[model samples]
Target chain A: MSPSERHNVTVHGPADGQPMMFAHGFGCDQAMWRFVWPAFSDEYRVVLFDHVGYGGSDAAAFDRHRHATLDGYAADVLAICDELALDDVVFVGHSVSAMIGVLAAAARPERFARLVLVGPSPRYLDDEGYVGGFSEEDIADLLESLESNYLGWSSTMAPVIMGNPERPELARELTNSFCRTDPEIAAAFARATFLADNRQDLERVRTPALVLQASDDAIAPRPVGEFVHDRLPDSRLVLLSATGHCPNLSAPEETVAAIKTYLAR
Target chain B: MTIPAALLDESAEDLFETAPCGYLTTAVDGRFLRVNRTFEEMAGREREDLLGKRRFQDLLTVGGRIYHETHLAPLLRMQGSVREIAVDLVRPDGSRLPALVNSVLRYDEAGRPAVIRTTVFDATDRRRYEQELLHARRREQEVALELQRSLLAGALTEGEGLELGVAYHPADKGLEVGGDWYDAFWLVPEETIAVVVGDVVGRGLAAAATMGQLRSALRALASTGFEPGALLEALSEFSRRHELGQMATVAYAEIDVRLGLMRYACAGHPPPVVVEPAKPARLASDGRSPPLDAYSFWTDRPDASLQLPPGGMVVFYSDGLIERSDRPLQAGLDELLASVDELRDARPDTVASSLAQAAAGTTGSPDDVCVLALRRRPART
Candidate 1:
């Protein structure tokens, strides 16, 4: 399948406008940017897509080895950019995707002009002097939680909500909202997201970046955000009053305003 | 028979305090705002210690807390409600309560989420049942896999002037084992080798069991010195009479190394490929018939013969090797032919592995694949 088909890429706004691509976090699809993407649609070409195995993207394209790390995801980003012939792109990434954007920009510096990272953590596990929060045991507990929730999700929601012609509304609402994925893929993505150590990759990213951190995010704490900022050579940190990991969903206005201010600069 | 009005006159506050399920309210960020008596009892904490001091996530295990942040919180924010979310709440005394939680996000007038109302239900029995089901499914998968491995085990007949190799790969997606099987054994003392590759019609334990039955039947029929076509004819009758392996497709071949002769039959399977020395590999498209049990009455199965020159090879493979969802059948066949032609100079085992690896590729295939190759060594002077 073509990369566009594999990632389920959807494009909006003027055909000639500057491209602004939004990549969602680990838990959800591109719909996580529902409220934020529209705010820039008129001025920027808004690009949205589901990661393979997440939303409408072809689940058959999910290769365990190909998607074993964040680099595989970054390759998808580059593929999208190449397929669309996009240049000087403005990339917005949430949670785990923020590091993916970093990897993409580091690989092909000319394709990206700026990166907006929301609630990103370079390393989730705590190190000797650094406080990334959580531990090895905590990550194991998180995997167990994911497995149980996936079980509940597949058993209760997948059969009735997925591809049911009688309940179009439910399917529409769930098109991107906690949509079902293969449990093994979900676990693999969780491992790739939490257990990753990409602290060194930040130094290689020459693109100007904006770090949007939520004040009280349990997933990506304030110090972790600061750690990411300190590593990037040309990045600024803005701590929003938003109190959760997903300010894009919880505080869309603040999230939009921060991105608009950074782009304006 | 209705209860008296006076007896049913319980106040809303009383009901809230003494409901059967634990009830609590929290801020949008999960900070505990109000806790009912039932909730306090369930958590084993005093109201003063719980209220305004603890967030809903604070009561969960580390894993449950992560789930709250990643799945539950995002879901509630998107859908305004989340139901039947399984979580383990760590009690004040260091014990755990397996609970099913339902929470709704209440928005203030400005359209901002202001409060969350949650209900927790004890789900110890349900959780246990679910775990048992999961365990049962895993055990079934393990048994099926083990059965497949044991049935395919044993060394292929190896002797002077002959070499054989086989490769088998199951689908990697689900727990159910697939129905692809391959076998090679000595039909005569040292002159001929019988090779077979077949695919049954289903998946899981039933498919594996059917494959085993068909494999055994084929070996038994071959042992009676039946020709390639006659053995398949009997195998089809065995499937119909036993009501097993309906619509199964198999390819059988007998290679006579001393005479450099190969007789093969295909029952609704891809024709075998032949790679001769100093020539491109090509598929043999003759001797084909419908799958086993495809018709109520059977016709005589036809056999085709080819003369394998010195240093010639023959490949028998399941349909998966030449069928992919993304490409046409002819395209896949052409790719296989090309891959085989490239490995003409490799050893028998190397060629078999290369063909299987090339067909399966890096991505996991949707179906199982099996490849069995036999080569006739040049006659020594």
Candidate 2:
């Protein structure tokens, strides 16, 4: 499970530098992370790997329950630690895995030095006195979309969610890979994720956290970004003026610079 | 009978050309948008011939035209999108095409209605597969539910003196149904009625079938005129003879209203409770018997009896009623008694509902349970 074996880990400068792990979003494997890693790997032991079911990883290891929520993914991060035997790691997770690092860091506070949650969501749906920006019905529609023609839905919906029509092919390809991940596993994960109320877990995160949000991200809007920053005790909010879900793909130089500055701070 | 390769190739081309799918797009107001080359071919018209001039509703067969104007159009207008929506489409020659269509709201840069992009899957093959899958699921549920419905509830014979009300609730957790059964029928001639409550381990169809077998034996053996002690021992032997896999918790009681005595047998079953006006009520008879299974290996104990003295309600419950995770069974039983006390003099049905709520309070999930309440009526002069 070491980042070196399965994932495309391109180190720009030093391998023995401080360790930082790069987690990819759904529909993408480690490659979704490639553009940003080259800039960060120079100053750190940059780690990257495909999630259990995606990319070059063994597909049989993926199951309905295992990848259903973030716990199993957090466990994968931990397994990477035990395999690489790295210590005092800086965890960087994107999309679903971003919140996963938050959980893992919260659960085992000692393993992580700091959390740089890129486009994280503690909860997706808004409630009374709480704002996550989606309605119950909206969430239901999203789930229905995922269930019906999951590949086409994700391919088509990613661009809509990202609001970057210029990268329609990118959105389609990302979604196609995302949809290729076992649907049953993804659906169960969707239930575990979209149905979860992790507001309590957010309050328990003690690590110094950084929230990197793309400016016009259809998925993670600005208010939700502010919400994550406000809830975290030791945190700062950095809004990249990028108009896509994965800013590392759309605006890598600014995203990399922001990450390097946040790590330095 | 020799078909040339060239002709076979032509047939394949025709098959592909006449494929069932007819792709189309429409404006938000349900006007004719764009039909694929195949779709225009299916309609026996040129693409230009069908474009712009036709409304989607107009292309529907007569029934479909009315259906879209009523149900489909209204819903899509309000809901913004509809999926797997079944409908029929009309061809230009006044023919109909059976299809399943899904549509979504497409908006212009002004966020106004732009066009509705629809992917219509020809339902002819898929409809059949989907129907078959649904039929199979329905059949499984039916067989399981039938087994649930027919298993022992209450057994009553003519001229019986005892009155019994029973409730059996399977765990609603959706895995498999546990086998919980009760019978309150009579023993003829002596004017005595027998009450039996038991839980067979495991669940689903097998446990249900085992329930049927055990309950039938209980009914047949009640007429043996033997004491409750001997009755259950014979029942255990009957279970052993059948080689039923799982064990059961059972209590069998014979009530004689005129005599006011209840002879009861316990096969590792929870003791029956009595709600009395005197002290905080207690379980009437506490005799114990081993569970009925091959590995039970315990010796038979004597049958116990108590006077169902006038105006008392005797409560017999299965083990699932008293089962709990952290609390002792006695504590769970106490909770049940307290809950029953809260709903004083509740009807048998109300009592069942209250008991169910009480059980829910113990754990997040429901376990199998069967409760039998037999009230002893006051005797006349």
Candidate 3:
């Protein structure tokens, strides 16, 4: 399949503006950036895409072997860049996508100009000397939760996750958007997201980067974010006051401001 | 009708406290603003502790919290209201309260999100029932797979100057086993061999059972020295008499190694492929008939014979091999022919395995595929 069809790429903003690509983390699709992407659309060519098997991307294009590891997702990023003929792009990745951006930049440094990682974590499981919040059992529990909830229940919980109880419409839109993903695909994505270790890939990213860490994130704690920043060669860390895994949904202003500052720098 | 003044004067606070369901209100970001007495009792938390200190999601389990962020919150933001969502709320004591929740977003005068009103209902029994149903579905899938495996287990006949290969792959999308089967067996020791491939209509256990019956019946009929067409005619009669194998398509071929002769017949199945030395592979489009039981009166089915020189191969396969949703059947057949042409001189096992792989592509197919290849080699001096 063509990259456009495989990734469900959507381009907005100006044609001549610098390209800004947003990759959503696990548990959601490109719609996770609804609040954050619009802030950049006025200045940059904002690009939003659903990973294959999520949102509007073609599920039939999902190959188990090709998507068995984070490298597969990195390949998709490269494919998107190549198909659009994009160069010196600004890539914004949330959660696990942060590592995906790292791998993509490491593979083709010329395609990216800067990297913005929102709530990034190089490793999810606690290591010997590191303080990644969750344990192996916790990750297994998370996968079980994904399996139990399935896509059928996504409509019910999407609003709560989006944290916009006031604007139920936003929650409803997100529910419909993310719930369309196949449950098998979602489970596979969960396994790929939590079990991944990308600490080594962090050192290879040469692009100037920004790590936007949430102050009280349950998924990726402060120490994990700091660990990522310490490993990254040319990256700065900005701690947001938001208190969850998804600051983009809960604290869009803070998330947007951090990205803007990084891009300006 | 005059009502008692005391009954009419019940306080609003009393009504709110004694409501049937738990009720709460939260800020747009899920911070607790106000929770009713019923909600406090249901959640097992004091109102003073929850009012400003906790969000609705904080009361859920880790899994529920993830669901809250990923699906529930997003749905509520987009649709304004969500109903009948099951979540396990963690009580103060660390136990779980299985509950069904419904929440609605209320907007302020300026059209901005302001607050959320939610109701919680106990759903312990419902959740148990759903779990039971899920377990039963998985058990059924396991049983079907086991049945299919036992039916397909067997050994093929091998001898001098004769080679045979077979491949079978079930549909990858569904949990149920498919009804495609293949068999290769010796009819006359060191002289003649029979190869058959068939697809029974439908899926799951019934299709598999029907496939097994037809396969066994074909072997029994062929053992009586019946020709390919006569064996099919008998099999069709057997299907009608036993009320089994309806609408099944099959191809049967018997090859005589000593004389290098091959007789084949098709019943609404794709014609077998023939590959000769220094010649392009071609479909043996002869001795064709409708699928089993398609005709009320069983007639003598016609049979076609071909002169197979040394190193000649005949390939029989089910429809799934040349049937794809994206392309026409003729195109798939042409592709299969081309694949055969490329591997014409390869071993029979390689040809069968490679053709199956080519038909499946990178992503496995959604239907069962079965292929059987038999080759007649030069007779040993």
Candidate 4:
């Protein structure tokens, strides 16, 4: 399948404008950027997509061996860029997707003009001297709890979760289309996201990066964000007062301003 | 009888404190604004300790916090409400209380998200029951897997002037044991080797058991000198009598290595392919009959014979090798013929594995695939 079909790529803004790709984190799909991407649509070619096994992306495209590590997802990012022939692109990634952008830009440095890493953490488990803000047991609890919490999500809920936004009346019937994912795929992605350690990979990225750190991100805390900024070759950190992991949703004005400010530089 | 005015006045307050479920209100960012007495008691903390001091997430394990920040919080923002979310509440004593939570985001007049009203239900017993059910399901899957593996465990037959290779891949979607199976063994050592591929009617433990019985019946009947066609006839009778593997499809072939002779029959199965060096692969489409125990007018089955050339290859496979939901069965058959011809120069093992992998690489087949390739050794100088 074409990468666009496999990843469910959607495009907006002027086709001739420079591409600005927005990738959502682990929980939600491209809809996570509904409030943020529109800010760039006036001046940039906005690209939005869901990762495989999440949102509108084809779940059947999920291959266990290929997606076992972050590299597989990174390959998909590169594929999407190549297919669209996007260069000097502005890639905005949130939560786990921040590291996915890192791996992609590191592999194809020339394709990306700037990397925006929001609430990014290279590792989640606390190790020797560094604190990733979570213990191994905490992650185990998370996965176990995820197993027990799939009551509201089933096969019937999938189409609603992946409902078309153009039809507002249909979309209005259920508010559940936001973060629900296939239970098996969700567990697999949870393992891939929480158990990853991309600290060594951060140094490989030569492209300039803007790190958007939240004031109280329980998932990717301050120290973790600092670690990401410090490890990157050329990066700047902007701490936002938004109190959650999702600043784009909680503090969009400030998030948009931060990116605009970074791009102006 | 008229109710007392004093009792009537306290009823609303009494219900909040003594309700069966806990109730709380939290700021949009999840900090607790107020918590009812039931919530206070369930949390094992006083109201002063919880209200304004702790966020609802603070009471949960760290995992729940991640889930809340990543899944729950975002869901609340988009949908304006979430229900039956499972989280564990940590008490002052460090003990965990499994709870089910539901929350609705309330908006102020200007449409800004205001406080979140939530209800918490104790799920200690429910969690235990869920775990038990999951454990039982996993146990059954494991049992079915173990049975399938043990039944298909024996090595394929190998001898002088004969090279045999077999590859089997179970469906990737689930852990249930599928109905496809392959077997290769010497019906008469050093003379004739019997190769069979079959697909039974259903899945899971019953299908695996049926496959095992059919394989045993085929092996036992083949040893007693039943030809390819007669063997299928006897097997159909056995299936009818035992009510096992009814309507199953099988391809049975016997090759005489020294003589370079082959006989085969397909019972409602995909035709086997024969590959000769520098010659396009062709299907052995002559000998065909209805599936086992199928209601049919034709009683007697026919066996087809072919004089095998040195270095020639013959393949026995289940329908999975030549069937896909996205394309016609004929297309898959054509692809099989083309792939077999391309791999004719390779070893039997390579040919078998490559074919299985190619079929599996596409939108994966829901059914398991089995391929058994047998090639006679090239003529010696």
Candidate 5:
């Protein structure tokens, strides 16, 4: 379908610089990248937007079944890339979006220059031979918390759910209302994000990838991070001494520095 | 500045005897050679009754006695020290008390095991805390259910110009009702009507409370005949004063029954879907302005004229209807748009029931879906 006449997107940054697409996690919108954007905006064309239901987007367009798969989110990323006419794009996803970016890259490897996955996981569920750090009950508690108040969970859980409980605002700082999303949409996302097994998809990620890991994370532990690194054919793992699911919020400078160091090469 | 090893070793007996933790030394034959005041307090017996008479195993509860006879003593004999092992002791009154035990075997000069010294601490507070946490979660679940009931009540009220129907389903059994809401009621007889579907930031009681405030404010401002934008502006002003960190997105539909036309406004919300008998594509609302409360140099249009057939239904809803738990909000919207024709495909006599069916149960619902289905009830020809 042609772009909706009412839909208009503005891409602002250096026109000829390395382009990067950054996706936010649950409970947040594109604004989560604000602090990290300043470090690269002068040099790179940065892309950010609320997920369809969140932020300043149209909410009525949201559908439950179609979006139950991460591939749908992956398709949205590619659509945004296509709209911008981006090539050799450096795709960066934070938290869950990081996993979405990996799936997107695996689908269309040629469109991406490198994949910068921050706190990414192939699957959150523990398999017979695999450990995802959290048990079923742990995720149930998290879902219950999210259902109670996504913002409250983000603010309160950011401390314990992330590596550091001291900086609770980091959770509050990264959130966006973009999806203007319904609780139903959030619930669907939670089930798809947590219960779905995507271990098979990691093997197809052929693009040179950088897994910028937080030393301590509540959702993605070192083992899960390493599992992603080991599975991706062309990847490097760099664990920074950051303590949160959102490194972009917890350690913006260090995260930016890592991005700078990786992109520079 | 530090005490010498010999002095420290010699003073260990004095320190252990006076330490806040319960300490006791048992012989190889299981007789208690020494017992501290802390141990005496733990057992509810005097040191004189305990020392040189009771065995370490005798103080353990029945289950603890079995565990000690089969597992603990053997483990401690093999490992030298077992720190922080949880156990239960039977006090003199036969009340079982939970505790954590740390023990090490004392050695003679030649390194032979002479006696076993153990330390125990009360774990009642920790156990109580765990129980309270479980209870708090249970109480929260009940509160979430109550919020859901209130969210569903009076959500769809009919007015002179409009007929309304709404349904709300929290994601799960005990989830807090999210901020999604749909409402249509007459604030001023046939002259004016209020129709709105808006989403407050976050979910649960806080969002529900804010929803009530915003919804009530809209109704309060409705009689003044403020246009949708002006109405939203008033709401924004109120929110700014209250300093609600969360923002709200709303789509408002106002009908002037006497004029036979309706005006619509959108603020950071999805456009309302206008459904007619046998026509789906023929109906759609123009979306404008980002949601209210996020400060920007944006203005809202007060009116857009629309001819209404008496039996036509205009659906006003929060994002929950089309929201997918796992996908971007847009994808969910797209899916919803694709299924818009389904609303029209139903039997005309049962359209109201069909619309209710769409949102009745949340099989595919990820969030709370609030839809206000309004029918003009065309003239009886």
Candidate 6:
């Protein structure tokens, strides 16, 4: 399948506008950017897509070997950019995807103009001098929580959770398949996300970045975000007053404001 | 048993405190705004200890905190309400309480997320049940894998002037055993050998079982001195009589190395490819018939013969060899032909591995892929 089809690429905004691609994190699909992407749609060419095996992306395109590492997801981001012929792109990534954007930017620095990493952590496990705020046991417990929540992921209930109030007809026709990833794929993605150590990739990135850290993020705490900022050659950190990991969802206004301020500067 | 209006009014506060399920209200950022008696009891803490002092996430295990931040929080923001989220609540003594949580994100008059109202249900029993189901599914996968491994463990036929190689790759997505299998054994030891690649319908343990039955039936029928066509005809009869492996596809070939002759027949399968010395590889599409138990009007199964020149090679493979979701079958076949031609100089084993690797590119095949290559050694230098 073509990369566009494989990733379920969706485009919005003016054709000739500067490209702004939003990448969602581990827990959800492109829908995670619903509140934030619209804020940029007027001035930027917005691109949104689900990662393989998530949301609207073709599940068959999920190759276990390819997606076993964050590099594979980084390759997919580049593939999307290549398919759309996007350049000077402004990438806004959440949680794990923030690191994906990091990898992608480091691989091809010229393609990206700026990166907005929301709640990013170069690594989730604590290192010798760094504080990642989680232990190996914590991630294992998260996997167990995912196991017990399979009932919430069932086709019957996923539709209810993913329902589009404005388009009830579309919801009915989707068979509740949106975000219906196989449980195995979910676990593999979790491992890849939580276990990844991309601290060194930061040095290779030349693209100027904005780090949007939540005030009390349980995932990417303050020090981790500061570490990402310190590693990147040209980056600024903005700690959002919003608590929790997903400031985009909890405080889209603040998230958008932070990106707007970064781009304007 | 209806209560009086005055009594109902007085009992409203009692209902909130003594509800069957734990109920609480928290600020949008999870700071406890209010808690009922039931929620306090379930959390093993008093309202005074929780209210204004801790966020709901603080009451969860570390993993539950991460899950709350990642999945639960975003889901509540998007859907306005989330249902039946599994989490573990940490009590003061550190004992874990498996809980099912549901929360609604309520917006205020200014259209801002003002508060989150949540209900918590004790799910120790439900959690155990889910764990059992997960274990059972994994056990089933293991059993299917074991069955497939034991069945395909037999050694292939090998001898002087004959080179044989086989590669089998199961579908990688779920690690479920597929129906595709390859078998090579002596029909008349040292003189002629039978090499077969077949695909039974479906997957999992049942498909593995069906593949085993069909493999045994084909071997048994070949031992009766039946020709390639008759062997398949009998196999189809076996399938119909016993109601197993219906619509299974097979490509059966018998090679007599000394005589440089091959009798082959394809039963609803992609024809085997042949590459002669210094000649381009071509598909042997001559003898073909519908799948077993297809119930076609034409009952006759014809076998075709090919003169295996010195240094010639023949490969029998399941449909996965020439079928992928991303491309047309003809395209895949063309690629296979080109690949065989490119790898013509390689050994039989190298060619088998290379072809299988090429077919399963970066993304593994959804269906199992099997390749069995047989080459007649070139005239001794």
Rank ordering of all candidates by DockQ, starting from the highest: 4, 1, 6, 3, 2, 5
Predicted complexes: DockQ each: 0.57, 0.02, 0.29, 0.58, 0.02, 0.57
lDDT of 1 by residue, B1-381 (tens): 999997587899878888888899999889898888888877888789988888899999987887788778888888788888889889878998888899999999998789999999888888888889888989999999999988888777788878888888776456688899988878887888788889999998899999999999998999997778878889999999999999999999888888888898999888889999998999988888889988989758999999999889998888878787778899888988988988887888888888777666545367877888888997788
- Candidate 5's DockQ: 0.02
Compare candidates 1 and 2 on lDDT and give the better one.
Answer: 1
Using all chains and alpha carbons, the TM-scores for the candidates as numbered come to 0.95, 0.46, 0.87, 0.92, 0.45, 0.94
Residues B134-197, candidate 6: write the lDDT tens digits.
7998899899989999999967778987898888877766677889989988888888989899
Stretches off by above 4 angstroms in model 3 are A150-177, B1-12, B108-112, B240-244, B277-281, B295-301, B307-309, B312-314, B338-361, B375-381
User: What lDDT would each prediction earn against the true structure?
Assistant: 0.86, 0.66, 0.81, 0.87, 0.66, 0.87
What is candidate 4's lDDT per residue for B1-381, written digit by digit as tens? 999887677677787777789999999899999889999889999989988888999999988888889888888887788988899999989999999999999999998889999999999999999899989988888888888899999777789989988888887555688888889888779888888999999989899989999999998998888889989989999998888998999999899988889999988999999987777999999889999989633358899999789999998888877787568889999999999988988888999999988777655476788898999998889
Report the TM-score of chain B alone for all candidates.
0.95, 0.63, 0.90, 0.93, 0.63, 0.94
TM-score, predicted candidate 3 vs. hidden true structure: 0.87
Error of 4 at B9 (Å): 4.9
TM-score of the A chain in model 6? 0.91
User: In model 1, how large is the Cα lDDT of residue A100?
Assistant: 97
Residues A200-255, candidate 2: write the lDDT tens digits: 77888989988998775545678878888888888989989864456665466788
Give residue B272's lDDT in candidate 3 (0 to 100).
94
Task: Give the per-residue Cα lDDT of candidate 3 at B86.
Answer: 72
Q: What proportion of true contacts does candidate 1 retain? A: 0.61
Docking class of 6: medium
For candidate 5, report its TM-score.
0.45
Q: Model 6, clash count? A: 0
Q: Pick the candidate with the highest TM-score.
A: 1
Q: Count the backbone clashes (under 3 Å) in each candidate.
A: 0, 6, 38, 0, 38, 0
- Rank by TM-score, highest first: 1, 6, 4, 3, 2, 5
